[model samples]
Target chain A: MTIDARADRVTLAAVAAEARVSISTVSKVLNGRADVSEATRERVEGLLGRHGYRRRTSPSSAAPLIELVFHELDTIWAMELIRGVEDVAREASASVVLTESGTRHAPGPEWLEGVLQRRPLGVVLVFSSLPAGVKDQLRSRAIPFAVVDPAGDPDPDVPSVGSANWSGGLAATRHLLELGHRRIAMITGPEDMMCSLARLDGYRSAMSNAGHGVDPTLVRFGDFHVQGGHDIATELLALPADRRPTAIFAGSDLQALGVLEAARRQGLRVPEDLSVVGYDDVAVARWSSPALTTVHQPLRNMAQEAARLVLRAREGASVSTRMDLATSLVVRNSTARLVEPTEA
Target chain B: MTIDARADRVTLAAVAAEARVSISTVSKVLNGRADVSEATRERVEGLLGRHGYRRRTSPSSAAPLIELVFHELDTIWAMELIRGVEDVAREASASVVLTESGTRHAPGPEWLEGVLQRRPLGVVLVFSSLPAGVKDQLRSRAIPFAVVDPAGDPDPDVPSVGSANWSGGLAATRHLLELGHRRIAMITGPEDMMCSLARLDGYRSAMSNAGHGVDPTLVRFGDFHVQGGHDIATELLALPADRRPTAIFAGSDLQALGVLEAARRQGLRVPEDLSVVGYDDVAVARWSSPALTTVHQPLRNMAQEAARLVLRAREGASVSTRMDLATSLVVRNSTARLVEPTEA
Candidate 1:
């Protein structure tokens, strides 16, 4: 990661001259200082980007740091992602700076300033896409960035890492089908997310491939949390004995836990009375009373890939713009073979 | 927050003169630059500590950063602590820098260098104690530090936050006793950990207070994880039916899940055939099949207090040297009144 290797790199002075601004003004704009006017900042940034101007690094200024930004860090999946970044950072002898900027972060002018000042080697964002303004800011400073998108959505212009959500849903549903379950219910994430739609389509495809028609009544949208699973399962379980599904496939592990709770409330035995399958084989999936038969999303590996991508890009290495890792089903004790109704 | 406000602060130049070194050498030592010799560095640091030298902060050098060092981040309790620090950092417009230096940090010589370079506002250590060398390094630079120790044992010299582990254990056992459970079993953490010993003592006290003798054969120590709970419970449940316990108290929520699985495998229904109580009411407690009756150890709050203490100390405010948060019992569906054996 030396500066002079790229013989074609543009000079800061050239960018300043092209923008018709002083070197100091260009520097201020590069550092994300608010002193420069918005128009002037944008023009300087455009010139810097077009010229492919990479900032010169001083021994003192090149801090061993990797910045990680998330929409929210309270989710169960966040820990796995953090551990992944930490793994890479540790090997590189770098420390990770963590920030939780909500989705409403407008191009992250507020958060972007901190990154610019810190001048981290690279950034790993836990979002589906980076805003245009934010992308420009990072590019101008030569601070490479990549997104770790769990939603299976990515911006065409941004480098991103995601899991095979469609495949995960397909495998989860197929496990129940193999268990001889005909009445299987599916609870997916919010309908608006691309990952949710992809997963739902996979579930439909699995049912279709099994020589069975999709039961519209057995499909429901969930919020991907425990409460969503609980609420959806509560009503689904309350249906008539003949109509109630003997198996349920949940969108996430948290949701699967909710389904289990609902089953326990009604005196139903897991794997015996009601089989349940979960997505995202997180810690709780295995720790749940009846370990969930679920799909592994490879969250940690995805995060590691994103961080590695950003670091390599920062070091002037060409890398993949998009990488989708595989997901697979893990059969635990939560699912069982379907049995006939003994009461009848 | 300002340099002039602290009239009693020692000067760097004075320390340099007293240590027979140039001001530049002191500067290098403060920056953690490796150019300085170890002998000179130690002498200069000793003089700085003795004289109480406080580094003058320039506006640009004051990074809005908080350093959090953990022995390991893989523990289940880490996420909550991270969130607590993030809460304070967000409110104060500071970002958290995380490092996972194992317990063998050796006063964090490798980690301390990075922290000194970052010049964060303050630091929160998750370990029970900081090595003398590490403590001296932070102090010479006037970097305030605090510990958020879950292990109960904490260094008296360090400002720390711990929970009422003894109370948690007592409450859990008492809950079982109140439910008419006489043949109760207890699973504490590793014997070497202060928390484990404290909790064990609490259980002993609770049983004695209720005029009941604790059955020696019914007690066991666990690793505070799911596997530990399961392995221990399996053997306990396998004891002769006449000597088998009617209730069990687990060391942690993860352990409680293991116990639940053990009960299921043995065809024993919880809260009916066997009541269970868990310590540390983490997320899994509520999500468990039969929601766990647990002791809530305010982990998040303890983290917040530790972070707050560090920040306040950094700003020259006097703060508590130690803070022990309270623990309370949460009655859920896992515990019930003991009923006579149906076989009898």
Candidate 2:
């Protein structure tokens, strides 16, 4: 069977001939107005590419399809980012192909190589930093890509869209400080990640601004998972009751949930004894047993904006345009008014 | 500017010449390998495709790529299914193209047309019944495809993989009976859907086997959405308190969540006053307040099976084979032991 690239493109006559029913049947197939036999409809479509027939493109494909790559973390966090990506992709009539950047811990060079090979319309890098060589490769390809909360300034040339993490960290810290909790501690993500550093910087800046010296003993780091949060929180709780920090700020919602579980296990009442704040207002944030008062990054909005940026870039926009959306603090039951020292 | 039909078969050398790049650079561009300059990669690819180079028959040509088409439902239901699809697709070193099957209430006849046009290596149709015509079209094109829980027979030629909804429904009803509840009602999905019918059949068979008469009034029609479940439950609650059925079997987890909310508005306590059993056991089911006693469908397994089926189908396997995965009852806090009439 000689592959006739043109034969797949369908013309009215070719469609009619293949359906083996009638010209009107083929017309009806294209128009979808009349009930041509399903058999005939399939046959006509098989000829479409051969005859070079172009069906009116749907709104979903408003822009060319781009692929979004992410490194897997928690189920909830992954879901939230995807939700944001979908919302943006849908409104823009662009489609996103979401793929695991391939490993649970760290995606290897091979993974990056595989993704770049697809020659996607564009690529959205989420929660993962671009390696030095990958950045060089992207620059050389002149591929229009955008970073969605990537680890660091992986590529200054490529635009990025993310929330102001330092501001979010400051807000979380300030909330805890206002509650009269002088002994506050924090749990953060991996050390090398830019997000962790930025969030940690925000915490330090907030503490310093509030006239308190940073206590190195009160800080710890872990992988961004519920167990990581729980383990860190447990270690903190095990500290002498008086030495334990009155408030804890977790870098992620998953970690916050873990903190909550740990607090519960230790029989500590929130607000009355311990207060916690989380980052990323994932859907579960609202539904968790003491609805968490956390930093609300517009994950969906970011995903949408990143998608728009990629599409715009693909349409030949400048590569240097970066979009940084704002983050807000959502107060919920997980936090409480800090009791005065006299009361304590 | 010429549209060349024969140009589709151009070799790498021709593409490089057109792009003014070396053949090695063209190969790197197509392979997504690092070290290539971006400018050279883009120019080479454009020239290759502009000249219509048929992708060479290489390892990359057989690279697994699966297309996922959802039934255009709310995010709540689609989330888990997509996750399941992603999990299996990633394991197989394949990529997923996410698309919707048009509007649920107003699906166009061309729904399948868009999918066929892409010429994806394999297609996974989720919660959709391939109209007889769509199946025939797939068969004639010999495109490898699999339907997830299709409502109709797949032309006796295509493989299908889905959770055992019938068994799931039966388990749900049996659990309610085992709890000593005599008068139980069901809220089912749309009549046209196979899941709805199969689940309802399970309820009927279980009730009959237990020597309980199936009351038509006790069952109400609903879509799988929360509002649909809530609406039906609300109507049932409107009946005199004593006349209301003691428990409700919701056809889906989303529907059950609504049933719980509806019961709460009427000041009813779960399991204590009105026991509820749900289907699908989605992620939310385990987290919802009071948690939910649900029938756990093997969505992940089914997704894996579907992916496997697509692989086989693409390799030209006959359709006589299919897979039906088993499900289990996940008993949780939402259900209670039926109170004795004398005690009440």
Candidate 3:
């Protein structure tokens, strides 16, 4: 139970002594050597974590590769993040090792074994947090890692990069309000994600700051996809003339497109009748007809920062990092000045 | 100079003798060891290519990593290809090594050196062809590779996977013509790319089969980008009412988006005033406001096929392959029957 003294001076001897194993066995586990028995490896790893035994760095341990692991490389944002990491790695004369580690919060133990063997320069994970076992193994092997948490949740002890979700939401709503729209609706992402709550809070603050009370029926929690946007917008547009919002802030670009589809189906002309704003100014935002007026979610820059941070961490710099890059409003063709009276 | 008989039985000793070096030096160069002098490495590589010396496969040489190289990881198609490679590699319990080889058609000597040192299971290049020197280095080291050429051009001797561009074009144009569109404009990709030319030729064939003459003014060679599509579409839309085409078969999804923008700018309603058909049904096609009617270029399947082919080659199978997966049409809101007479 006396953890503080052991945490300060964590050597292989101390870890092996506590685990009741030889130093060579602990070293075998550290190096991810195959001959070590499973039971012995687990016991050594537990002691190493408990003792905070940081692996001493060596020249051969840092290979000329940056590991980029994702739960799922979904849609446009994945490509942007990949490009960002690839750019930084190329600049440092290193290649990228891409991994889709199943649809989960963290990769499995099999992936950990490979990483321990590869001993990459650094790792950039596109997730909010890592499993304790994975984190301990990475630390014991001296592999630095940083998370690119676009979903806005970050573990306090880990280094991470994220976009300013609250600011993005505020800017998106302000853009619509400036267009002379008094009644505005907001569709944020899934309820579980911290990003959704942050965006919703931003929307509420914007409405209250403008001296307007937000109508409960005008707010919705969407799945951050096209179908969700379409479904929610359809219900909103079907409201009575005085109750329907004249403008909508779709939290993501995909949702904005869905809103556009719903508006088209209802024979409502965009900008002319109902203005729309989107977040996550992805490539689709620019390509959509009447290019979206949205918020730019600095995703590529976030990934780039994550890569740089991990690299910096490997160089023995500050690892206690939680940096949120700024997001900005992109005014395109989607929003327009209100020509009709909005007295909702 | 006598490559005929030497091609049948090539060994390190033969290559070393031909290059005027020791067999150990040849072995060092073959293993991508940095100890060999540049002059000796080049000479050994030249002799290896000339004699067609293929290294015998070994267990250690085939690492559990698939190298995926690209010149530029642009907008969206790159992600699809990455997913395909990732899927196949995951099924094979292998990881993917992603490399951005500059904006050139092939990676440089530095990249090739790293690849040789890694000695991966296989390489999947997203290029039309490889340099003779790079190809020789791969073959001499017994590293299997296959190209995923979205461009229609393919190297005759090398294995590659491509979609049926000509067929894609034929399908897109036929779909538009079947909708009672007579004056159909065809905006294909770059004039130099074989895919662009093949697609244009298919359009021509479709027109001829429909008992119509191909109009020179109605066809344009574009850069297969958004700006090119928008610019070309703007010009086409500005033509005299009688000369303007009612339907346009935009060669790629990006171009189709451009076409949509141009139509929007011109205040013309899609499917009502102008019908648009896009090639390469990327995800953007579905997200577009009036989802594009497009040719489904099986880019993901093509990449999967390339990975599978290279993996099979690694297992001592045939490497001489050229595959063109079929392309089909995806009908959406962009194309519709012409309400007015299209006798232009």
Give each model's whole-structure lDDT: 0.87, 0.70, 0.88
TM-score (C-alpha, index-matched) for candidate 3: 0.94
- The residue-by-residue lDDT of candidate 2 on B222-311, one tens digit each, is 888776888899888888756688899998887887887688667677768889888887776765545689998877677767877777
Clash pairs, candidate 1, are none
On a 0 to 100 scale, what is the lDDT of residue B258 in model 2? 80
lDDT of 1 by residue, B190-283 (tens): 9989999999989999999999999999999899999999999999999998889999999888899999999999889997889999998887
Per-model tally of clashing residue pairs:
0, 24, 0
Off by over 4 Å in 1: A1-22, A34-61, A104-107, A341-344, B1-21, B38-40, B50-61, B104-107, B341-344
lDDT of 3 by residue, A1-344 (tens): 24643543347788888888888888888877778889999888888888778876753557789999999987568988999999899988899999999867998777777788778998999989888778778987779999999998998878999988898888888777777787899999999999999998989888888888899999999999998899999999999998998999998999999999999889888878899999998888888888999999988898899999988888878765799999999999889998774333
Off by over 4 Å in 3: A1-25, A341-344, B1-10, B13-25, B341-344
Span of 10 residues, lowest total lDDT, candidate 2 chain A: A55-64
How high is the DockQ of candidate 1? 0.78
Model 3 clashing residue pairs (backbone): none
Higher-DockQ candidate of 1 and 2: 1
Q: Which ten residues in a row have the lowest lDDT in candidate 1 chain A?
A: A1-10
Worst 10 residues of 3 chain A by lDDT: A1-10
User: Could you give the C-alpha RMSD of every candidate to the true structure, in order shown?
Assistant: 3.2, 15.9, 4.2
Q: Residues B1-344, candidate 3, lDDT per residue (tens digit)?
A: 35633553347778878788888888788778778899989888888888878877654547789999999898478999999999999998788999989756789888988888788999999999888888888987889999999997898878999989888889888998899888999999988899999999999999999999988999999988898999999999999998899999998999999999999888898878999999888898998878889999998899999999999999988766799999999999999998885443
